[model samples]
Structure formats: structure tokens, C-alpha cells
Target: PQQPFASSTPQSSNPFGTSSQSTTFSNNSTLNSSNFSNTINCNPTNTMNYNPTNMNPSSNFTTNTFNTFTVNYEDPFLLKDITFEKVEKKTAPFSRIVPKPIFSEATMKPLLNLTYRPPRVTQKKKIYTEPSIEEARHLKEIENLVIGFEGKGRIQYIDKISGTELTTSNIEDKITFLKNEVVVSDPPGIGLNKRARVYVEGIFAFSKSQGDFIVGKAEKYPLKAIQERFVYSLKEDPYKKFVDYNYETGLYVYEVNHF
Candidate 1:
């Protein structure tokens, strides 16, 4: 060869030679094409290492850093799905109650006076005679009335015209006679802006033993005062009963309804 290539074989006692072993030793540490490209891409400082002979010498050789940041061959186990359960609510017994209808200005119209009256002869002779009898019977009736309402209380007397209290001495005789007279009413008035004319004939306590209440301490024989817890009962009409006189208004009020 023209100027034979350098070899490791001795050359006329010259020290330098280019044998295969010597040639390979210098190239072994040099990067292949693929290694040079990867180095250049990953580090700008190593760009000088990207020589033409260094890029992918064989297709089978792949760098470890090649797919680390990409999804091209990522592990399938990293993908996951989460699930959760839904709960239903339970209701309590008697949770719903029907409300009763409320009667008020907003819900219903105001009610008018509801009175019951029987036909009457405005000018009957008996009416005139009865008033006279009533006046004649006053003193006697007063006594009976006192006896009838005995121990009722002070307020019970306020409703009457005479305003006499039987407890006093002056009205003693009048009070006694009233108790004996009967109670009767010819014309009944049961409504607003009206009046009831009552004629009480006899006094009767529903339970006679009930009278024992007024006789309290009578056994003591102290000749002392006694108080009777009296419960007066009377029917105002065929339909309803009025138990007693209103201690306040003195107006006849309905009794406790049995129904």
C-alpha cells in the first residue's frame, strides 16, 4: 500500500502501529449515533457529542430515558376507577297529621245573631193580668226568691230590679216567701238584644242531700252562720239548659253541656 496504514505490528522498529486491537480501543468508548442524539437532546452542553456516526447504529437498541416522560409504553396499572354507595332516607310514623279547618275572618264569614222565639200575642189580656199578679206577688215572691237563691252569693242579686239581699234583716220575710213560690215563664227570649221573662214556681235542688251543704256545722249547734254550695239547674228551652245566673253579667248563661 501507498504509505502502509499504521498498525500495532512492528514497523522497522518504529513504535506506532495500526492493528485491529489498537484501532478498536480508540473507538470503543465513542458514543453510537443514537447515544449521541439522546445526549444532545437531553443536555445542550453535550451537543458537541452528536457526531454523524453516533445516531442509532441499530434499531433494536433503545435508551432508558427514551420513553420515561412519554406515554408510549407506560405501565397499565397506574390507571384506576373509584366507586361509591348511595343511601336512602327512611320516614317516621305519624309524620303527617291532617290539620283541622280553622274558622276565622280569613277563612269564614262572621256569624249573625241566632235566636229562637215562639209566636206571641203582643197584646194579650193575660200579659196585663200577669204583670199585676207579679206585682202583687212581689213581697211574697221576694221571700221565695231569696229562699230559692239562698246562699247563691252577693252577685246573684245584682241582676234583679229590687236589689234586695235576703241576708239583711229588713228583707227576711220577703226572702222566705220567695222560696215557697213556683218558677214559671210565659214568654221565652233566647237571643241577642232580647230578654227572658222567667216565672219560677218551686225550688228544687237536683239532689236533695245536696242541701246538706248549706247546713254545714248545723251539727255544731253553735247557732252560727251556714253556707250552702248551691247548684241551680233550669232548662231555658226544650233544647238547652241554663245552669245558673252569670255571677258577673247576671245574664242567663248556658250550663255545662252534657252532650
Candidate 2:
């Protein structure tokens, strides 16, 4: 009768059962002599199945009646009884190898076709600097004039009509002669004149070939026709041998002739 071991345990304020209440026992709670003797007899009867090493000090399954212990329990990690063994290394050595290159069926046909002709390579003809329009026109004119000379000898003219007759050697002299010889409302105005002196070796030059022949650059002509007769003169005579004719001294001296 020690209050029957206070059948209900103490309670706490914890709602989730994380903490427990303190335990209390009466100082005079002692077992009776008869009950103690009976407990000793019962303990010996269960000694065959009892294990002292495996005894749990505070387990819920204990041989007692007064101490009504409740299991304050929880399952932490839900563990399994798993067993592990040691791992061993491989017995033999391992290696890796790389294979050589091989031509596939799809690429072979196209490659063979590419090599059949041995690859003919031709370079396009190129002119680095193109000629200007003006230069090209002048070149065409020269070509046409040269073509005109293919058949017959070019008609010729000269400034000197025979050794007995002598006319002006320059454009000014030619203009004065034309004014006195031919009558007109007005004389033909001098279009342009340029002084170009070329020495003669064989024939003389023509009056028109002097400076008055303005259309083209200077060239010599000799013995040109005047309608019916061949006026044996030297005007634009290309073959004429030019000489410096001193007008003041009235003397003619030979000089080197060039184109």
C-alpha cells in the first residue's frame, strides 16, 4: 500500500511528446517479506530463459507489476539490417586502341571522278591598264589610214614645183601666194599653224605640208597632181631630204631628215 505505485505517471506541457515528466517514488515503499520471497521464487523459475548481458535497464517488457513503465518511444531513421563486404581489384591490365583511317563507300566515287582528268587549269588573258577613249579613237584612225594604203600608192604633193619654180616654204608664204593667185570674196582664213621642221635627204616638202597642213601631225609629200598634169613639186614629200634654206642669204644647205 505505497499508494499502489501511483498508477498514472506525471504529465508535461509538451504537445509533440518531445519531453518527459519527472519520476517520483515514496520513501517508505518497501516490498513485504512474503512478496519478496515469492518474487525470488518466480525469478529462479525464469532463470533458464533469462540473459543478464542482454537485459535492458529501462525496457517496457520487464518482470514487474508495481512500476508501470510506459514505452516513451520513437523510430528515428527506419534502418535496415544491411551487411557490407570488401571489394577486390581487377586481375588483368586494361588498354584502349585507336583504328586507322579508311575511305567509306559514299566518298570513294566522288573522289575518283575528281582525279580522272588531272585537273586542267587555264589562266584568263588580262590587260592591266585599259586604254582611254581618246587614245582608242586615235589608234582606230591610224589603222584605217594604214588600210587605205594597202592597194595603191598614196597621192603625193610637194611645195617646190620643179627646180625652176620655187614657192613659199612656210605657211605664211603659202597664204600670201594663195591670196594673190586665187580670187575670192574672202581668202581662206588660216585654221591653225604649228612650226615643225624636218630635214630632207631625197625630196622637198609641199606648201600645205608646212604649217598649213593642220589636220594631222607633219609629214612630207612630193610631186602631187593638179587635175591633169603631174606638178613635179616638193610639198609634203616624205622622202625629201630637208636642208636649212637661208632666206636672207638665198642659200640651201643639207641637214639630217627624220620622221
Candidate 3:
């Protein structure tokens, strides 16, 4: 083998020497046995030039490049794409105004004569007539037979026609004489000219009697007498007409002339 050509420059023991030949040896270049006979040339401008021989045109290779950039602006600011629009303002409708009415003076009229006339008073002649003899006798008989009890449960009535002494404990027995067409005299000393009816005191007990035949058969009996015609006060002058049996207590008063 011919002795390998040696360079005139000093040989360095460092594999990565600062020589141009060592700087040109990069990953992009290939080393082969045929390239050993060729001499390499390097430029001082740090650029590389390579010519490969018998390289396949269909060889697969890939290269990628990336570029990065940075921008700076004020924080919390809106972008240029953002826009604002104009808005329309709304107003309320106006109210209608009303006019006041005018007043006119009224006319006055004359007063008319409104005389008030008094009504005529008529006076009738008074005619006084005496009572008939039969009427006088009947009135005397009623006055004599108007019997009243002196105390409770005591009969003080006397027969006017027969002149017989009558005594009974039953109230029905005392009122039996007045059942037949008897006339009640007006209360004495009243002088009011008002017709009188017989009022019996404590006679309402017979209204609830179921055994008293005389009280049950009497016309217009003392049914509801205690409720309808009961006299509340003995102080009232109207009770003078009442034939009170219990004159001491004077509790109940009932009208019994209809019976």
C-alpha cells in the first residue's frame, strides 16, 4: 500500500480538534471507503457543500421546521373585533286636559197664600134615661150575689134567691152559680163607666184538673187563663174587680166571667 499522505500541519491528539476538517464532519455527511481517496475542502465562512454520488432519488427523508413568536399589550382590554351599537330611548304618552263647566244664576218666584182653616166642632145634646125596673132588680141581685172568699180554701158565698148558707173547699163549687147567665158588676168606686168582668184569684189550679166535672163542662173554662189574663200586680186598681180567694197572699188573678 502506498504510504498514506500526511498533512504538513501538526497532528493533534484531540479527536475534536479546531481544524476545518474536523468541523466539517457532521451527522448530515456520510463516510465510506471510496470517500477515503478524496480530499475534503472546508471554507472559513463556516458553510458546507456536499456532493453525494450514486444516491437513490427515491430515498425517504423527512425534515420539520417550527417558528414561535410573542406579543405584549395592556391587561383587561377589549379586542379590536368587539363593537358597540346605538340604543333608542322610549318616552311616556301625554295626558289629556279637561275644561270646567260654567254656572248660571236661578230666578226666584213669589210666595202663595197658604192659610190653615180650623175644623168645625159639633156638640150633641145629652139625654139622660133612667134604668128599667127589671134592669134595676137584676143589678141589685148581682151586687148581692158578688161573693168573695175571706181566706184561702174557704167558701164565703151565700145563695141570694134561696137564702141558703153555701160552704165548699173546691173552687169549682163557688164558680158554679155564675155559670148560668150571670152578669158581672163593675169594680166599686171606680166611676170610669167601663164595663166589668169577673176576675177570680187562684182559679188557675182548675185548668190542670182532670177529675173536676164542673170545671171541665163550664163554657170558656180557665184554659190558658194563667198565661192569657194573669194579673201581675195587686197594687193595680183593675184587680179590685178580682174575687181573690187567697186575699192574704194575692198571688194569681184570672178573668172567669166568660165561664
Candidate 4:
């Protein structure tokens, strides 16, 4: 308009590429680029194709379809309406209460017969008879005589004529009168009711008779006088005075040769 204000140099070129559009900026304005106007397709459809050649041959893949299930609920207290029945219990059948006997009746019959038989009648057998009192006294006297004869110098028989002591020859026959019961009455003047016997086995007849005389006078004379007479008679008449050797000693002395 004042001749279109002319400049001396060409107009400085714009640093940004030239656009026909203009931009405006203010205090409450917003900016938007042209790329922002292009929106991404957020809800997209799968457009990829299945390719068999690109898949691995060793892979195991499966397609499984499961059926759907549904659940229903009922009252929790339904168990209270149910009823139960009672059953009776039975025991085993009864067996024998006692055991069988150890012994049978057939086997025990013989034993019972033996036990019930009649009692036997046995005869009375006499073993021995008891000795009488007189026989007992005689046996005791003989036993004492045997004891006295066994002692030294207690009783002896001597030969009147030979003046030697006489001894038994057969010792087995020394006790001859023990088995035989010989009764000799007491000497005549002694007034005794007793009985005795003297036997000197294996002696001379004269010595045995002298033994009898001495044994008979044993009740009358003291044993010392009788022993003294055995030696004193050797100095007197061998046969006659020997029996009457010590007749005058005392009351106990007796004429045994006459008796």
C-alpha cells in the first residue's frame, strides 16, 4: 500500500518446512500432533493362519472338551428321621460237661469180682508153749551153773587117787545136761525142797562122782572150805577120806560122802 513496502534482500527462509497451516498457542490451549489422530485398533480379530510346516513334528498337543457340572443343596438334619432294628445274638450249641471215664465197665469187672469174694478161713497154728514156773527156775539154775563152771578155779573136778586136775576132753560135750531135763532131789539132811543136777563131761568115773559130791555139798559148805578140801584130800586116803575131808568146819558143813 505505500507502493507495497519493498525489501532489499530476499525474505529469510523458515527453519521448519513451510506449511500452509498456522498454529496458535494460548494459556489454556492444548497441542496435538498429526500422528496422534491415528488411533490403534485395540479390539483386534486373530487373522493368523495355521501353518503345518512351521509346527514341530515331535510336539504332543491335544484338544480336550469337558462337560459342565452343577451341584444341588439339601437339609442337613435329614439323618434324624431314619429308624434301626435290634438283632438277637445266639450262642454256640451246648457240648458235654463231663469227660469220659478213664476205665471202662468191661475192664473193671474182674477187679470188682476179686474184691467182693468171701473171706478165707485160716487154721489156728500153735507156735510154742510157755515154760512153767518150776521149769523156768530150773533153767535159770542150770544157766548159773554153766556160768560158774566157765570161771577159773570156781568149780573143778580132780582125780582123787592120781591127784591131778581133770578137764573136759570133748569141749562140744561139755554142756550135755542142758538139753536133758534131769531132776535131783536136795540132800537128805538139808531140809531144802530144791532140785539140781551136775554133769562133768569127759572125766574119769571116780572124778565125776567126786564132782557130784562137791556140787551137792555146795549148798551146805562155804566155797572156801570146799576149795580147801580139794587140796587137803590129796594127803588123806585117796578114795575114802577125800569125800569127808572137811566135815567138821561149821553149821554149813555136811558129810557129803555119806549123803
Tell me the TM-score of each prediction against the true structure. 0.14, 0.12, 0.15, 0.13
lDDT string for model 1 (142-223, tens) is 3112223322221112122232222333233222223222222212221110122232322332224444222222333222
Give, for candidate 2, the lowest lDDT window spanning 10 residues: 146-155
Kindly list the per-residue Cα lDDT of model 2 for residues 1-259, writing each as its tens digit.
Answer: 4553322345554354334454443333453322322211212223345456567666566467887856534534434445578899756534324454476544544534544565579642221111323343434222111101111111112211122111112222332112112111222221211111222112222344344312222233332232112112232335444444322222223211211
Candidate 4, clashing residue pairs?
none
**Candidate 4 per-residue lDDT over residues 1-259, each given as its tens digit:** 2222221223233334332322222232223232223223221221245345556777676745576544334636566567888989876555555667788766444535545667789642221112323343434222222212321111111212111111232222232222112222334323121222223222111234355434323444355465556545443533223222232331121111211
Angstrom error of the Cα, residue 102, model 4: value is 17
- On lDDT, the candidate that comes out on top is 3
Candidate 4 deviation (Cα RMSD) = 32.1
Each model's number of backbone clashes? 33, 26, 0, 0
The best candidate by TM-score is 3
In model 3, the Cα lDDT at residue 205 comes to 30
lDDT of 3 by residue, 176-225 (tens): 32221223232322211123344333343333465432222233546445
Ten contiguous residues with the weakest lDDT in model 1:
185-194
Predicted structure 1: clash tally:
33
lDDT of each: 0.31, 0.29, 0.34, 0.31
